[model samples]
Target: MSFGTEMENKDFKSTFSGYSKVEVDQFIAKMMVEFNSLSRENNNLKKDNESNQEKINYYMTLEKTMQNSMEIAQKTLKFSQNQAEKAKAHADKEADHIILKAKEKAKAILDHTNEKNELLKNEYDKYYNEFETFKIRVANFIEVQKNVFSTSPEDLELSPLDLTSFEEYVLKNIADSSEEVDDDELTLPELFDDEIDHNEDAQEHDDNLVKG
Candidate 1:
């Protein structure tokens, strides 16, 4: 039918035509050798394909691992940045709070100082006013005393010289008398009782004579 079939039929005819046994045996050996060589070559090609597939699989796995590692690194970097931002914001808020507290305390201290200064100033003014009043009263009293002394007669029953000396003597006596009175516990009214009694007696005597 075909060339291959025709060749196979011819080969069969030749085999049956009583060829020599040595020649037939040699032909079978040559065919076996060719079959064994083709089978070894096919096995070698199959082994080479399997090795190449294993290398491709290994390289693909390595690529996937590198991609996963990159993703993890990116996520970590983003988280770190967020944490840093939060920390900075918190620090800024705390710093503002501290500054506000300091300002309030400083204001309170200044207010207290100002109040104390005002109080001290008021007390100084009050004391100064009282001192001025006392000075004025003392000066007026001294001026009145000077006028009285200047208007008094020179040769009256109490001479000027005597009055001056007597005033000093009386002042000294009064100081001494005050010291004695403090120790004696004497009252002012009781000290003048004898002089008042003598005056009443003289008046009563005159009234009796006038009535007679």
Candidate 2:
């Protein structure tokens, strides 16, 4: 039977043979108080367990969220590194290309300068040769004139053909060596012409003497 029914139906044979009613009643009351206290404790323990489970679930979810955030951060870092490497490579390539272009330009400038120098040297040589030739011709003309002036008047009258030949030689040398000179100090050609005029005047004087 239930504890309540047992408590209610508990009988006594008589006052002398059975237990005292007051003592039994006090013991049953004490047991009922202990059972109620134990029940309250068990209910409190169940509530605590549920609260702890909820806290555990919240912490687990937070951990999962943190893990996902870490993954994203790592991906971002890797992507940034890759982009930096690409940028550096591109910069290096552009720098190399610029350097190569600068070298090529420098080489072209040097080549053109060398070619211009060669042309200037050739022109200088040509002018030098012409100047030397002009000086030689002038000297030859001067020598011929000197020889004509040294001859006697009688010799000139007798060898008129030799005088003509000397005159022709001077004219031919001057004509062959004539060139435009860009100097004011050189007066050989003009002096040679004056000498030729003087020789012609002397020849006319000798002719007048012969006729007289």
Candidate 3:
């Protein structure tokens, strides 16, 4: 704002009691020209500083925005990770539940199978015992019949009875010739006549067959 070193080097002529006016006016005019130049430069520098401060403020605001974005991104990523972990845990739990249910179902199926097998075995045993008992009884009956109807081989040949007609023909013939006597029932006149009629009819059927 003040003059340059020229003002300090240049001296004014002394008048009666003060400096010369002409010289002072000339130096003052030159200092005003330089001061005006410095003033303009100072104003430009101030404008440049203000512009730089505005740019710095804008960059600081952008940094804040970027910092906020990063924080939000991190938070979102953390939230997603937590949700994924929960999903995995839930899936594992479901898997365990399914496995447990399957195991229980398998056990139930096995138990049912074992029970059915046991019941089948019991039924088989019961039927086998019944069949064995039936076989024993049939064997005893056959033995009894064998003992009661036993005859010598010669007698069997002598009396070669036809088994097809044995009940109706051979028994009557054998009884007629037997030594054992049970004459009470045979003495009944009505039954004896029925028997005689039956024998007559059988003899007539045999005669017709022979004629044919």
Top lDDT model? 2
**Residue pairs in candidate 2 whose N, alpha carbon or C atoms collide under 3 angstroms:** none
TM-score of each: 0.53, 0.58, 0.58
Candidate 3, residues 31-82, lDDT tens digits: the string is 7677778978998999999999999999999999999999999999999999
Error of 1 at 6 (Å): 20
Q: Quick one: ranking by TM-score, best first?
A: 2, 3, 1
Model 1 clashing residue pairs (backbone): none
List where candidate 1 sits over 4 angstroms from the true fold: 1-42, 151-212
- Among all windows of 10 consecutive residues in model 3, the one with the lowest summed lDDT is 179-188
lDDT comparison, 2 vs 3, better candidate = 2
**Model 3 stretches astray by more than 4 angstroms:** 1-26, 151-212
Give the Cα lDDT of each candidate: 0.62, 0.69, 0.65
In terms of TM-score, the best-performing candidate is 2
Better of 1 and 3 by TM-score: 3
